[model samples]
Target: MEVTHAVEFLLLVLLEKLSWSDTKVVLPDANVTCIIPEDCILPCSFKPTSTVVIHWYKQQIPVHSYYYNKDQFGLQNKHFSGRTCLFNSHIPHGNASLLLRRVKVQDRGRYKCYTSTRKHNQEMFVNLEVKGQCAAMVLAPVYLGLATFTASADCFYLFAPAQLWVVERAPIQTVTITMTDEWVTCSSQNVYPVPQISWATNPPSSQHAIENSTIRTTDHKGLFTVESMVRIVGNLTSYTYLCSFKSADKTQVWTASWKNQEDLTYEEGHPVLIPCNAPQMLRNFSLTWTFTSSSEPTLILRYDNRTRHTVNQWEGQAELDQDLVLLGDGSLLLKKPNSQDHSGTYTCTFTAVNTKRIFQTNVNITVAATSVDEQSMQRSWWSTAASAVFVLFTVIVALLQCVKQNAKENRTASHRHNGTGVIEGGLLLYMDLNPSAVRVRPHGAGAHEQESSLVTGPDHCDRTLEPSPEAEQEEEPAEPAEEANEEQRDRFECNEPV
Candidate 1:
């Protein structure tokens, strides 16, 4: 037993030496992007060696492990069940990357990949960041100037903590020319750090030449909305106007011009192309398209020197002519125009990369209903005509039924009159003197039982009339005068002879 214990101790020491010998520590930091419920790979590799053992850990928790020529999942964390995997075939090549499936929010953390072999050991570190799902940006148009310029844009982010900076944007900016004064008003909303607004006139005017008014309001979100107005005191012939919104640092400025405005029209269902030609002199300039109608204006698209971004609602609907955009033809192609909503004014803005000068052009779009809508309208008219004819036929049939029922009632009344005897001049003149008893029948008595008699003697025929069950069930009560008249007629007939 002593010898056996001695041999076992020697074998353990040998195993320890084999585990620690030639251990190479390789600590490299890696960055990985992981979206929720998607798979991500944490990369870690080392020099190939024999009989490899790999382990992946999140902080101190065991995520996954590979040992004894197979994957050892029994020691994996419960949160990673059925979601952790490693490339077993690559193990021989010293590639021990951990593949995490269905990534959760909790999966964001520092990860360590430790690999060991009979002669070598190495480890690598990785940082995982979980982000939300990605989506495309949508753009609308914002309208500016008298010629109906509109501009709009849609923006989306691939990760959280996004930021938006509008150098100068206004939803309700307008210029009006009146008999007395020329006025220009500009308004912007949802801005941060309190932007500044100013006005400049062409041919250079003094500060006293224009009257200015400004208002600013802030919301609970700590963003600002501003409105600025400028009026030329007297009737001015023709002067150019510019409105500018400058950043607090004065490094970035947005300008709106009143001189460069144009009008355009297009039919529905057809594509529209608004031309924005740029001179060869302009370089490193950005182009933006906006739409403005009777409703609010919106940003449609923005093309910086490199890429084109489409704003909300206009994604996939608006696109720049890629081949011609760089050539200074910043024309936009609008697909399948809708008359009710798309008919509005569009604006194209060009800003130089280094200069504060801005150029703008306006296009008015008019979309009418297509031939399909007209066909549907025609079908509606035919359906209305058919319904009218059916109603007229139903009314005519109802009238014919009423006329037939009235004619039958008139015939019945005439027959009843013919069956009754009339007393002349309100005098009961006995035509028959037979001393027979007269029987008076009720109103609903059968016609075959009807009898007429006359009795001239002093003894009169006596009888009482009782309403039948059917007559008692009637909702309306009979008049007393009619019953009395009936009784008098009975008495007069009874006094005469039958």
Candidate 2:
């Protein structure tokens, strides 16, 4: 038994030496991008000789401790005890990958993967990046609790926490306070950190909401929908309202308006039809058209009811029909199309006796040219000609049928000749009328004698005519003969032999 154990030990040592010789460790390049609060993985793997030990480090600091042979290092790293783990449980198979759970902005940094073997030690590195979650941006007065917000990216993680500040301009005061999910609401009676705060929301306008004099924080399970209002101090004044939010790291996304914004659609060069009918006559109205390139709109046309005339880059090309007594339908017509007019918003404004309204439309246009080959053109032309030929053939057939019917009647009349009726002004005269007869000549006594003799004269002559079988018939159809006789008599009565 001792000898057998010695042999097995030697074999195991040989295998370990072979594994160390073939060991290869690699890691993906660092500097990756990840949205805030999103989970990410930093891949790592290595091979080892006899005994293997794997460890995960964060920026050279010990993160997850794994002692393959000892099984004790894994219990020491408290922060990574439950959050970090190896990809495969069977370490003998040479899988040294690490998996991270619930990543945060603090997780955005360099990570190290290390492996130790009987022969040597190997290590690899990975870098993580965190990005903001929401695409919707808002800007508002610095009052404590006046707006509730949610972002597009749900993976956001709280980083450094967020703080509200009261910024002010001379003559105007601004105040803001940090809020928690539990106390999302504020009232006029409850004071806040920010008071006497007011600013105009119209960008350069200075209007603000007064903040209550209280500091609140809560560890809520989910996001909070903030409700806020402004108590105007001193007197009621007109001020624009702005709403804004910051990322976990205080990054501004974008801002939208509480008021209705216009979406204009139009095409370049085509006349944009702006039909206007106001309840009140627009005596104080002015019409304007603008061109937007990139994202900024530039004025191109303007009209005022006072001036009764409009000015525009497309001035002469524009036509407007206006009526004063009753609100006339103000229609603007544009002539001559071009690509520069292809995209942008066209707006029209009309001010009536009491109310002023503005309307906007957007236009987009595309143009293209096409080319055809010679073969296709030839095919099309020939196809048309073929149809014409077919129609002509049908017409000719119909005409020929009519001519044939008339000729047949003339032939039947000629066969019932009485006193050798003259063949004049007949369609058969123009045709090879007698298909069976070789010629027509005056039949005298000698001509009849020659025809009879010729039949008996030469062997070259076929029987001159076959005797009609009806000639030997004991009875004949009396009706047809009688009708023929009547027709012959009628003809004789019309023209007697001269």
Candidate 3:
């Protein structure tokens, strides 16, 4: 009898829609799943003729937890602000689906839709699943990253989900969204076979494509750099973009492809291993590391089956363990992650042996820890060293250029300035060694050049007096002498004949 009852309940449990006929309230049950850093919209509708109040709530501890409505809890939860919006512009007499702007893992909960009519009250349940979206979203997660993603509605009913690729701002690949009853999937495996996202364009510098390329661009606090590079507010902030290549045949290729939806939290000084992989069996693969400080790709290191030192500060310290196996379960290990490694996308590339089959994975790491005094001191030393080296290089180059320019200027001046010119700085080609003359144009002066006029002291302009040698001598006295003389002289000594 119990088995029959369960079977009967399963057979009778059918997905249905709500109606607003005759001032009666009816509810429907639906389930929704979204990934973190992605957007999800709840589909809902109501009959246009019913005069009812619709409310949405997150059902968990409290009996009543309203999220969206004209009033009430709408003003309470700040997280839902600008994130929850009504799908239909005409809500009173049209669809009332709620659109959650950016979904997070914590947002997974049971959502209730209530419609209170003049005569009856009805409700619906929306089961939400907030899983990490694409491998990219899990690997390199950011809010608002999920935009303009729509999969075939029919995919939701299929068993084998199709890949849904999100191509925003022409992301160099065609992405298709295929859904299945169990899950929705997104893939960027060149559905249409486009060129890889140019690392040159990633940091977006005017640079060429290279195996290991890095670009550095300062992202101002309020400035948008990548998609819509706009300065909404202030000066630029610094960010690094790394461009690398990986192959499918490299050892530990799967580790690179596996992306984590959750943020990796770490304590200070401890090394963390990030899984990296090749597209195929990890056998023939080449890995490189690069860093971007600003609009330029600073090459760090390239794996030539042998480790090579790079000019990048971080890459110089990078070392790959030869004894460790990178095939089948490919992984990249960092010796020690410091606060300096806090923000940036770490790219791992794999290349097939003697083939062009390359696979790549990007992992964004955030390091949060208090640095030890020694580590801080070491960081300061390295920072100072790098700054000093850069400054020295700049100064040396500038001095050399100045010297070369000075020689050129000396030659040019020898030809132009027969007796008076001296080389002051390099490359001042347009500068006048001996400025001929500057004519001061009086207020409201005409456009044409005017004849030179003598500039006199304020009291003597256009006013001439009889020659008084003593007074004339006093005119050009030193400032201190003038002050002393003024103090020594009597106040009424200069008496005007009345």
lDDT of each: 0.61, 0.45, 0.42
In candidate 2, stretches whose alpha carbon ends up further than 4 angstroms from where it belongs are 1-31, 48-50, 69-81, 136-498
| Angstrom error at residue 178, model 1 | 21
lDDT of 1 by residue, 437-493 (tens): 322332332222222333424664343333334433341344534555455456544
Find the 10 residues in a row with the least total lDDT in model 1: 149-158
Q: Candidate 3's C-alpha lDDT? A: 0.42
**Which residues of candidate 1, in runs, are more than 4 Å off?**
1-240, 243-267, 275-280, 290-299, 304-316, 322-327, 339-347, 357-367, 371-383, 386-406, 409-498
Give per-residue lDDT, candidate 3, residue 110: 84
Best by TM-score: 1
lDDT of 3 by residue, 83-194 (tens): 7766445666656677787775456678877655445556678888765333232232223333223322111111112322332221222222222222222233421112
Error of 2 at 345 (Å): 68
> What does the lDDT come to for candidate 2?
0.45
TM-score of candidate 2 on Cα atoms, chains taken together: 0.26
Clash count, candidate 1: 50
Instruction: Report backbone clashes per prediction.
Output: 50, 37, 43
